[model samples]
Target: MVIVLSAGKLILTPTELLCRLSSGATLRALPDDIRLVTTPPLLIADAGAVSWTLPLDGVECLDDITEFYGFAKE
Candidate 1:
């Protein structure tokens, strides 16, 4: 499981192990370490096993996120 936060109109995706967030900025975190802090118009993520809020524009329940990646293989 991975947590994604949309930065403005931009969506950050990981290629293999690297996740690029912005120009010349990147972050690395294991999926299990991810936690969400929900607030209106912004969702905060706490990863890297540390207590911090990585602010995001939106949040979603785990179930709904499946389609965002792609349909499951048969």
Candidate 2:
């Protein structure tokens, strides 16, 4: 599944971590979720109970994703 975090539609903070998955909607998460997972190439984010491995290996949205999650560009 694909996640998109631009505005504050989704919430992922010290107190809360949320991800509402839809059939064909945008999936969003916080920076901390990914940081605790790994690096840029391996796009991973935790949704409390489970971890999501995004299938964006060579997509242009990677830049946007990195910026969105405050990931260090590699």
Top lDDT model: 2
Q: Cα deviation of 36 in candidate 1 (Å)?
A: 0.6
Clashing pairs in 1: none
Question: CA lDDT, every prediction?
Answer: 0.38, 0.49
**Deviation from native of the Cα of residue 10 in model 2, angstroms:** 11
Query: Lowest-scoring 10 consecutive residues by lDDT in candidate 2?
Result: 1-10
Question: How well does each candidate superpose onto the true structure, as a TM-score?
Answer: 0.40, 0.41
Model 1: lDDT to the true structure: 0.38
Please give, for residues 20-67, the per-residue lDDT of candidate 2 as tens digits.
443444455556666332244445677698666654434444664555
lDDT of 1 by residue, 1-74 (tens): 35444532223243222344655566544433344334443323345354333455444532222233332211
